[model samples]
Target: MFEELRIPTLWITKVRGENTVEPTRLAPLMQYIVDKTDKDTAVIIEGIEYLILENGFETVFKFLTNLKDNLLAKMRC
Candidate 1:
């Protein structure tokens, strides 16, 4: 649905439930989505380090960054 719906979405897979995704796997997934689309996406994340990522997420928030960067670059120069 996400590939065509154009809305940002996430699919959760369980560990020991046929497939297991590490909680840490989420980081690169988030980065990949950002790189692929411009829309804001929310993930229903549950992890031990979840609370610690609030500030860190922003540092890697480059999804649709070209749009942001382009606009900022124009405004600055």
Candidate 2:
């Protein structure tokens, strides 16, 4: 979907394939992208229900909160 829209995306999955990030390692992957990209970059996280089903609500929530905080901090800098 994103490809057809011309939006580049990094796929996060547990399939252990090339260029794919495992769901458990989402934080580091997201942090890496956040660090590398400019402030104008917009991260669209789909499949929240899937993530929650795989990792539980608390874990996903904390991950999202941390990501948001990190992005906000980066923007402030």
Candidate 1: stretches off by over 4 Å: 1-4, 15-21, 39-77
**Per-prediction tally of clashes:** 1, 0
Tens-digit lDDT track for model 1 on 14-74? 3433224333455555455445443343434444244235335543344234445544454
Q: Tell me how candidate 2 scores on lDDT.
A: 0.78
The whole-model lDDT of each prediction reads 0.44, 0.78
TM-scores, all models, native as reference: 0.28, 0.78
Tell me, by lDDT, which candidate is best: 2
Query: How well is each residue in 1-77 modelled by candidate 2, as lDDT tens digits?
Result: 76798766766788877667777786767676676566878887878887788789999998888888888888899
Candidate 2 residue 53 C-alpha distance from true site, Å: 1.1
Clashes of 1: 1
